[model samples]
Target: MINRPETRDLLAEARQVLLDSLVPELGGERKYEALMIANAMGMAIREQEQQEAGEPESTDVMLSRFLAGHALPEESEQGEQTLARALRERVVDGSDRELRAVLRAMTETRLKVNNPGYLK
Candidate 1:
């Protein structure tokens, strides 16, 4: 599991890389910013993998575990909006490197599934 400090360090480094290396090369284009934004999105998704196995359900689990507590909501009531909101809040509020890494991985996973660049 990733502690808070680790997540902060990673985000700091990623921000540096984005500012120092990526931004300059893209000539201040929004598309280049999109790439970095997409990467950070992927990293946030990866944080869920750090959960322990076989733990009993609890409030902490509900808040921290991505897939946890999802069963409570009906299909009609639940959708991408809820998840998206949660994700946005978490990544923005969090300062953890591991969580950011998870977000980055998540972004990659989403890209693999259906990215505009891959359209025929």
Candidate 2:
């Protein structure tokens, strides 16, 4: 299980940690950064969806199925899933420049979130 701090007021703080310490070093280059950003955005979206669902199960089996891949899928009809969409998008429209932009944007937005202290 993830040892997320209990004091966090929002998931945005978690995103900051990811941006500062995780995204930059991923894949030995920036190639994984866009995928990470898309994944984060997807997670944020999922949180909202769950809140709307009212007592939605935490273990989303459908998402688990998408995650169980050598690489993520290419937009499954089951849903507008992010990991799969990211994988597909990367396959189709990925470059170092584009990936860098994504990583930078994610990191910046994460840093700008309404969280306590420095985004470190």
Candidate 3:
């Protein structure tokens, strides 16, 4: 059997390399792009860490289950496309308070992963 570093560790190392080695050598738009890449890697590392710590299911999974529980007869299949359409419909209709709450929670969860500084 072979052993390897976890995905989060790999991303962390890659982000560190970008910040410590590559970012210094880059300039102008290239530096900005590299910094953005490093930032994305950091977000991925945080998300992976959250999963490893046994956090709740991802927002997409939770939304899928929510749709399943409230699916219409025409939405029996409950595929990703169907769920997206349903969510959009609910949003536009502006009736389902529960759906609105779920969407808010999902947004916050995504913000926590993507830009925790925004929340602060």
Candidate 4:
């Protein structure tokens, strides 16, 4: 049986059309703008697919792992806040090498879903 197109699937088709047809017809600034929009749409589609497939919806997993490096104190609202503050401070006060590694992972995680252009 045929199924209705899901929103993500529709967006995927739209992005394909934008690149295969619309982009070819454009030039200069307009072409760049279309590419930007297409890129955003592609990211959105990938995010949705990842979510539907039981993958993480965001970078919380990586950040949580990083934070887990330290022993979390007693679990409480205030305790959680303190732990978070401590984690932030540690990252900021960390050695250049340590900070660079953590920050690099953080930026890479964000870029995976936001704008991965620099990776190219």
Provide TM-scores for the models: 0.25, 0.24, 0.68, 0.58
Candidate 4 lDDT over 4-115, as tens digits, reads 9899989999999999999999999999999999999989986776667644523444445444555544355443354457757773355545435656665665566677
- Identify the leading candidate in terms of TM-score: 3
lDDT of 1 by residue, 1-120 (tens): 655566545665776677667666675567576576856644453433223222222323333444344332324544344445656766333554544554555554445434525533
Estimate, for each residue in 81-118, the C-alpha lDDT of model 3 and write its tens digit: 56567656663344677667667767777787888899
25: Cα error in model 3, Å: 2.4
Q: What is the lDDT of candidate 1?
A: 0.48
Question: Which of 3 and 4 is the better model by lDDT?
Answer: 3
RMSD of each: 15.1, 14.9, 3.5, 5.0
- TM for candidate 3 is 0.68
The window of 10 residues in a row where model 4 has the poorest summed lDDT is 57-66
Q: Where is model 1 more than 4 Å wrong at Cα?
A: 1-5, 28-31, 34-120
List the candidate 2 regions with Cα displacement exceeding 4 Å.
Answer: 1-10, 28-34, 45-120
- For candidate 4, what is the total of clashing residue pairs? 0
Question: Which residue pairs overlap in candidate 2's backbone?
Answer: none
Alpha-carbon runs more than 4 Å astray in model 4: 57-84, 91-111, 115-120
- Model 2 residue 79 CA deviation (Å) reads 15
